[model samples]
Target: MWHFAVFLLLIYYLINRRNSKYLLYPPGPYSLPIIGNLLSVWMGLKNHKYHHKLWQSWSKIYGNILGLRLGLINVVVVSGRDMIKEVSSREVFEGRPDGFMYTMRSFGKKLGIVFGDGRPWSNTRRVALKYLRSFGYGTRSMEVIIAEECSELVKLRASDSGQPVLVNQMFNISVINILWRVVAGRRYDLNDDRVKHLCGLVMRLFRLVDMSGGIISFMPFLRHLVPKLIGFTEMKAIHASLQTFVKETIEEHKASIDIENPRDVIDAFLIEMLSNKENAFTEEELYVVSLDMLEAGMETVANTAVFMLLYLVRDENIQRKVQKEIDDVIGIRQPSLSDRSRMVYTEAVLLETLRLSSVAAMGIPHMALEDAHLGEYLIPKGTFLLMAIHDLHNGDLWEEADTFKPERFLNEGKLVQDERLIPFGLGRRRCIGEGLAKSELFMFLTHILQKFNLRIPHGDSLPSLEPVDGLTLSANPFSVIFEQRSS
Candidate 1:
């Protein structure tokens, strides 16, 4: 029976191959029957967490545009700055994948802005951006919220001065609090156990899945066959807890909702859902979208801030230089967006962190909306798009790419903006939280630097600059002593 099944799969693969044999697909390694490149890709990702680098090495052999097949799904890994920009900017390559693992977190369907596509995604994203802006997402008001959080974090760290702080998840609470202020119109205490629990769940979720998405994303049948082995069970539990948080928040908002005057983004979305029954907005979507914002907003900013601190602590010279810049520019005043213009070296440090870390390395996979030509190769309809953003940041494009040198981003003390370094991604699918993230990172980092000196704890070695690889790059578990600055 197994032999017969294999025979049928071989015939099926042959027929599909014959159909596309004449077309010029991007070059790639050979794929076998039925499974395609699934086994090889899975093994590579499982053994080495450097998914982007693995693809980069493959791109070297198969040109800049490398192709592969995972089961029946066609994937195109596009490398280089121009090629990534070309695919990202084009409408033909703007769709998100609909694989089970991709949508499983959002209740087994593409409901949220991150994983969603088509007109519904457009409508929801439009509404989200509008409401987010109104609730101080990109405005000075947003900076105020971030400053408040940063102040609280500084206080908390100051209280624990000279202690070995596990700084890995240190920034999570503050980052999430800022997001909550914008989204739910409420903030949690710095010591809130609930927020800490959710942070733990989110970190676990990141490790369970990645940009390559593991075997379960393509071959979902294994989820039922070996749910525990593939992390399906734990993933669902995490999503459930997170979904409950969103649902409860939505309920709270609904009880106090004033449709005439929306207080926050949730209220605004609730009003839209309530007022327009004919619209695409639904209760489930509201929950999922809220989850999306919370999950996306919390992890990236916090991780990047932690990475910045790690880099600073590892190099006293760099940290002191940044502090010197901060001292020269801001002096005693609280850090603000207005100060960002004058603090070039500090800005370069943040940029270098974003580039070197490249947390969302491969980024969310994009799907082809229609048959298209990417450079010299034909991208058939339904092809998955994976841009090598990590390579764009660390590849041959930049001199001393792996070295965490902020000076590369500076020219005569003025920050040099590089088009190749797109840590927040690009084009229409760019991160909506870019403005908020920058504000949070700037405010948190500057506030901490202004108030204290980050140092490796006494008698302890420097924290590893190498990040723990996952869906995003995170600083490995480490600690920093917040020495009170004598100014």
Candidate 2:
């Protein structure tokens, strides 16, 4: 009876919402009346592993923006640099797409501020940026935390007594401590069970989204009403774990409020939450907003570092270039912000790493809040524009863009920036934690390389650079030797 009812509902929706006649909706390969191009998307997506092929397949036919549907919802995939730049520039399409994955995993409506659009996102972003700067995000204080975490990581790896450790386990603990410093204001050693719990929760949340088959977007009604009817069983466990962790952290901050010297992000937010309960800061906003930084900051950073090292282990030439640049600039010592400019090739390597291995393959989806003109199409209000960062990164608008040639970023042996590759994204909805993510990647990777060279496990072949599916393109496990680098 329930299945029949859902079928009837889908049929009803197909008739009413299946109209893709809008001039602005952009044309693509056809979808079924009810499913609306989902099968087409699934067909092109390889290994359920590489979903970028879905965008690549359609983009080959439809220049930049291609529209498809995940059941009832219409999705516009922005596949080129021009389309992404244009759509992202529009304030109308500035908020995160609402769904079960975003809600349950991203801390929607619980203690985070990512769901809402328009004035609310703007206001929250403004204050949050201020708080981040206050917490010394780009300064030495932030670097100090990353350094501390790296030290703990070294100690833990060293305890393995030269045996290669499965980097996923070790790197995750290091990543969480960095988040702890950013959000909670304290650094935890590897021995801390809290660090272990943080990693566990992050992985659990990742798994929920990974297994969903885009069904959360397809069947929002099921998730909103009967979650069990859908496949988000682990979601509840993930929610409870994350919520408890966040609530406890925020409460601990409340108990130990220091008006004199605010140390961490929580302390700064606490001051704001206490002062402005009405306008800029609210109790709900503080908890959830901090939750946002915690979640977004950790996952992306960790994934990126892991990918960079994974690539470095296989592509020894690139790794050697990075190390040579680091050594030439900062010497045999640890890298510092002062060495930031001097480390030209290191900087280039980082940029190329981001470009080749974009953490968010199809970046985050942005929703149109108001109708807007985009090229030959006029996007209506409430439409979604999913930016295919993979296309933008791989496209050869720049020479030899597909290959991981770090030198492409260095003109005449000096580092430069490429506006074409917006890995952290662009415009109002750009990642707030960009600065910290960059810092963590640089510090963590350089620290590891300075001490040990990353190589594929003995007798094991180099791992493929192809990415697995999820919100981010995480490189799967490839055994490697963390052989000590010569002094």
Candidate 3:
């Protein structure tokens, strides 16, 4: 028994030594055999609220560019602006990881813009953007659609005057309506059960993805052996439901699509599909792409808006200042994209909210398509790369990073763009819906502040700014009393 134990230990040492000769992976925590650093990483991610901070802490020990092994995959996390810029600029680092989680979510293949990479992603993104622009995505006409939803939102809130309400719930439908108008050429009624169900599924899908970590992502065999233990079953059900919803919408569009004059994004995509049969333009891919737009469009902007409102409610002085700006600039009229230039303080507040919350936190992980050099480290082909955007948002790059100071984004009372603030991410994989999202956020926020004063419910104490941990950082649901502001 003693001889056998010694032999096994010798074999393990030799294997590690042999593997180390080929790849000079960056520094990371001590990993265990087979499992590597999965257990420790899982523990850190389990605390979702502090996960980004936890990654930052790890970067302190492992340096800005660090590497870890999660099961069979080599994971690299890049921090700070300079190092992140170095990694993101390389085309070799543009691939999306084909892990179990990514594959499963994208219908057993790389299908959509979010997780899909290479030719498929490029093709779909080009078509989507072109059509979206043609249909007034970033134009004044788009703001008209958003402002209509904002008006409806104000009316909805007014109907329940003096009641404590979950501000996200109020904003969710309005935000979704904006995307729906862009994507499907129609909007769902706020009370529609179909919209509510789809929203719930989208939220659940993100939560499940965040919770599982390596178990569902890297370890595929475990999912089959113990689906419930690793949340595989639940995630599959949500994905299936979401896919069905998107498919139904696509089919409905097909039946009514006018090839001559495209109505919305889906119709535009179908028109492109007719022209480019050789490309990755398929009905199934369209479903996934449309679903991606809907999910990202509604969730990120709405949550950020809610977080900004939460911060404003906590600081009445800030709220008053923002409202005063809104009142002065566009009094008693719907705020437009044209008015955004004059609303400097409001823009600053939104920028600060994005910086502090870091909604997507790490953003989506990038995969190495070839052996790459990031600074002094060698990232082997197929390795996963994650940019610590949260760290950049909270790093030494900003003064008083912990405090919620919108003034950081203001230069001499004018809103100035900062390169360091990358909430929508950067590089080839930067969010395509950024233009639409910015429009929705600006219009919705200006409209709300113009009409109402968001305050904590009469009996409740001010809620903490600490966000709920998930795929995206979201404020814990809190009731807000929307008091109609006196004219």
Tell me, by TM-score, which candidate is best: 1
List, residue by residue over 183-247, the lDDT tens digit for candidate 3: 88888777788788878777766666552245677667688679988878988898888888788
The backbone clash count of each candidate, in order, is 0, 5, 0
lDDT of 3: 0.81
Residue-level error in angstroms, candidate 2, position 65: 1.3
Candidate 3: minimum summed lDDT over ten consecutive residues — where?
206-215
lDDT of 1 at 277: 80
Q: Write the per-residue lDDT of candidate 1 for residues 1-487, one digit (tens) a residue.
A: 7589679878988887877632578888788888888777767767655777678878999998998888767888998888888888998899998887788877677887999998889988998889898988878787788888889999999899877788888988888888788899989898999989999999989987667666677677787779999888998899889988889999999999988889999999889887788864888888888888888888888888888888888888997898888899899988888999998888899999999888888877999998888777888887889989888888887898878899998998688998888888889999988877887788877899998888888788877766777788787888888998998
Full candidate order by TM-score, most accurate first: 1, 3, 2
The candidate, 2 or 3, that scores higher on lDDT is 3
The TM-score of predicted model 1 comes to 0.96
Error of 2 at 383 (Å): 1.7
Candidate 3's TM-score reads 0.93
Which pairs clash inside model 3?
none
